[model samples]
Structure formats: structure tokens, C-alpha cells
Target: MIARSTFSNGIVLCCRSDDDDSLLAVKCIDIDECPTSSLVLLQHEVALTRTISHENIHTYSSVWLSKSRLCMSSLFMDYGSCADIISSHFKHGLPEKIMALILYEILTALSYLRSVNLIHRGVRCSHILVSKNGEIKLSGHRNMIELSRDGIPVKKVHDFPKHDSSMLPWLSPEILQQDMQGYCTKSDIYSLGITACELANGYAPFTDMPSTQMLLEKLNGTIPFMLDETTVAPLIEDTSPSANADTEKFKSEMIEAAKSRKFSTAMHQLVTDCLERDPDMRMDADQLLKHPVFRQIKGLSKCQILQPVFEKMDPISKKASARVFQEQEEMMDELNRMSMCDVEWDFQE
Candidate 1:
């Protein structure tokens, strides 16, 4: 195994095959630790992936149950994910053109899913895998909703995903509201908008707030915009008379830095259209694909479009090593807090 990472309910192993020398990501879940509901979802995910085929969508190569663990293997992506890229290289987010190209490909995948009557409930940067060759594929289909029943289409769905707490931030407000009027595929568009902001800002907005507070913010139609030169700077509040000059200077510096990161009006409008508070008002995947921002890369090949981003990135292996170390530290901290193991192994130099 080259490296491994743990999530709330599973561990993903990055390894090379002995026979073919091909890289693979094997996601394993301990059957004993996994709840019955989660197990069902895993099975559903496998089935769903098997029935679909798209260049921009990830599918598993094999799935098996052995040694009290459910293991599924898929091709390992070179860049890991958009989130990984942001963490390792683009700390303040990606370039506007690169983000536009990535989102364009994502929209293509979404359009395909919509045709098959599937709602990819998860649409965050972490679920969007980036390749060394500039391809972006959407994963995280474990929480996907099938909008058709017995060959009949369902307009809206009311059920909530109980899979992960981290998804709460990306969920649409209509889903969070839980009223009589349920959410449809449009819900994913809202999440796409959030993902765009995450791509442009390096981090998701409202993540700092508690779940309930974040829920309230979304419910109140507080949409997060791209953090770029065009975005208005938040007011700097300082009461100290001695600190006034320092605050002004700091604010001026922030403005100057932001000036270098200006995004086009079309990009801003696309995000605004997708993030409409009302599900009906939000642009669907097909509509979003037609947005003006996507036109910027109409004739460009994937390599041409993403070459700058690739050039800007640090070495993938170095980034992965650093990220793996950080993830290990976090996982160890969480495991210790749970007190499931009596013995502790220190991983310090």
C-alpha cells in the first residue's frame, strides 16, 4: 500500500496491483463497525455505479466482501481531488479559467446523471476527483437519489441523507427545510454553486459556523459568492484609537491582494444563477451548461485549458505525502478521543 486514509465509516487504501502494476484506490468498510443503513447505501452505490458509464463519472472496477470488510476498488486519481489541490497548492483557490473548465466538465456529468434520473446528492470539491491529465470525474455516489420509481419519474424527494455530517453544509436549503415542498435535481445545482465557491475560495463558506447556524444562514437565503477581487471586503471593526492606522493599512493590503484575483462578470453570474434560494429559480444542469462563463473554453482542449493549473501545482507526490501525514495526525487524534484503543502510539519525531 502506498498510503491509506480513513473517513467516518471507511478506509481508502492507495495501492498498486502486483500483476498489472496499475494504481488502485480500494475503499474498505468494516462490516462490524458499519451500521445496517450504511451497508445498504454501500450496496446501492455499487449497483448504481455498475449501471452507469461516463468519462466524467467514476465507477468501481470490482467489489467484494471478505474478512468482515466490504472492499471496492477503482482507478486511483493522480491529483486526488479539487479539495486536495486547494490544500496543497492553490491555498487561496484556483484560477477562474481552470475552475470554469472543471465546472464545465462537472456539468456534463450532471447532465448525464439527470438523463438517467439520478441525483448526485454529494457535489463538493472532495467528491470531484482531478486527474494528472486534467480530467475531473465526479464520485461520492453513495448518497445518490434515484428519482424514478417503476419507470415513473418523481418530481421531488423528501428523504434526508444520514451518511455524513460534513455534507450538511453542501446540502440545498430546500432539503434542509424539510417542508411539504421537497427538493428535486435542482438541489444539486445549489451544491454545484457551493462547490464553485469552494474552488475559488480554497475553503467552503459557513464551515466555521455551527451546523444549526449554517442551516439558518442557508435558509435565510444567504448565498456565498466567489472570494475574488470583485467581492466586497467585510468591514473591519476596531474600536481602539491606537489600532486605527494599522487596521486601515491591513484593509488596504487586502484590497490590493484581491485586485489581482478578479473574476469575470459571467463567472459571477453563473454562480448567482445556480445559488438561487428557490429551487425553482435555480438553473438546472442543462441550463447551467449553457451559461456564458462556460463559453470561455469552448474550443480549447482539456490539456490546453488546464496546463497553467498543472504548471502551478507542486509535485503530486510531495503534496500527497504532506496531505497523508496531516490526515494521519487527524485520524489518530479522533481515534484517541473515542478511546476505543487502550494503548496509544506516539507518532512524533
Candidate 2:
């Protein structure tokens, strides 16, 4: 293994073949450590991903049970998730060109999923993985749902997605309402718009609020837009020494920070279209694919579009890579002292 990283229910091993040095990301679940429910979800993800065939959708190359461990392997994504990039290189979010490229790739994947009657309900930054070659893949398939059942088309689904409160900021207001109208693919479009804002801004909208307040904001038609000079409202004057004054001062500081950067009108418009409170008014994946904002990245390969951003990210990437190696080494040493070393198992693909 080249390196290793721990996740919620398992660990991911960065492995290289001894002969050809080919790399693979092997997600391993220790049968002893994983709860039965989590293991079933992991297995279900592999089964669902195996049937999906798209350049922008992540798929498992192989899955097998080895002794007390279950492992699923796939092509290694070097740069990891867009969230990783934001945390490491672009704390204030990515540039418009790069954001456009990322969104374009994700939309391509969503279009393909739509053709198969699939709703990629998990369309967040952490679910979008990036490779060094500039390939973007959409993951997080455990919560994906089908729009049809037994060859019958279902217009809307009333069932809620299986995720925690952290997913509320990305969920559409219609979904949160739990009304009789139900929700359809447009829900994903709304999430895509929220993801766009998350990419353009450093953090997600309503993230600082309590869960109930966040839900209220989305339900009350509060839309999140790209943070830029044109969008930030002018600060109102408040000279009195009161609680409201402190709040106004805070707003003033936020507006000034927003004014430090400028974004194109097309970017703002795209976010607006995606975040429409009415699901019927929201743009679908196909419509979003044709948006003028994507024109900025026209005719450029993913790698070509991200070249400059990658150049700026090289030093940060190198440092992070080194840290991973060091941590993995320590982890391996600890594992060597464990009594499970004597265990052996069959491997399958």
C-alpha cells in the first residue's frame, strides 16, 4: 500500500502494483469494526456502481471478501474531492473557470443518470471526486433512487433521502416541506445549484445556522448566490450602541469581504436558475448543461481547463501527499503489532 486514510466506517488504501506501479484506491471495511447496516450499504454501493457506465461516474473495478475484511477497489483519484481542494488550496473557493469545468462534468454524469431513470440525490462537493488527469467523477451512490418501478414511471417521490442533518443545506425546499406534491429530478437540480454556490463561495449557505433555522431559511425562499462584489448588499448605517448595531457591523464586514472578489453575470444567473424556490421553475440537468456559464470552458479538455489551478496547487498537493505517507507508515507499524497478522484469506475480483 502506498498510503492509507480512515473514513467513517472503514479505511481507504492507496495501493500500487509491484510490477507496473499501477495505482488503485481500495476501500476496506474490517468486518469486526463495521456495523452490519454500514457494511450492507457499502456492498449495495458496489452493486449499484458496477452497473453504471459513464466517464464522469465513479464505478468499482472489483469487490471481494478477504478473511474478516471486505474491500472494493477503483481507479485512484489523486486530487480527491473538490472539498479537499477547497480545504487545501482554495479556502475561499475555486475560480469561476475551474468551478464551471467541475459543474460541467457533474452535469454530464447527471444527464446520463437521468437517461437511466436515476436520481443522484447526493450531489455535493465531497461526493465529486477529481483525479490528477483532470477527470471528474460523481460518487456517493448509496442514496441514489430510481424514478421508475417495474417499468412504470413515477413522477414524484415522497420518501426522504437517508442522510443526516448535514445534508439539509443541500436539500431542496420541496423535499424539506414533505408535502403531497412530492419531488422529482428537479430536486437534484436544486442541489446542484447549492453545490455551485458552495464551489463559488468558501462555505455552504446556512451552514452557520442551527438545523431548524437552516430548514426555515430554505423553506422561506432564501436563496444562496455566488459571493461577489455585485451581489453583496450595501451596508446600512447604524451608529447606536445596541445589539442591532453589532449585527449591522457584522453584516458590513461580510459585505466588504464579498466585495473583494468579482464574478461574471453568467455565474450569478446560473445559480439563480438552479436555486428557484419552485421546482418546476428550476433548470434540469440538460438545461444547465447549455447554460452560458459553461461557455467559458468551451472546447477545452478538463485537464487543459484546470491546468493553471493545478499549477498553483502543486506545492500544497506535495505537502499533503507527504503527510499522508507519514501517517500511513505509522498506521502500518501499529497494525504490524496486532495479532490479526496470522489471518489469511481468499481474494476475488
* Pairs in clash, predicted candidate 1: none
**Candidate 2 runs further than 4 Å off:** 1-7, 18-20, 234-257, 315-349
Model 2, range 1-349, lDDT digits (tens) per residue?
Answer: 4334333367787777565786788888788887776667666677778778999999888888999888888888887888888877776678889999998899999999888778878889988998888999998787777787676989888878654456778888988889999899889889988999889876778776787998888888988888777776523333444358755565565566678888888889898998999998888899889999988888888898888667766633455579888999999998988786577876976
Worst 10 residues of 1 by lDDT: 234-243
Which residue runs does candidate 1 get wrong by more than 4 Å?
A: 2-5, 17-20, 149-151, 235-257, 312-349
lDDT of each: 0.82, 0.80
Clashes of each: 0, 0
Best by TM-score: 2
Top candidate on lDDT is: 1
lDDT of 2 at 285: 90
What TM-score should be assigned to candidate 2? 0.83
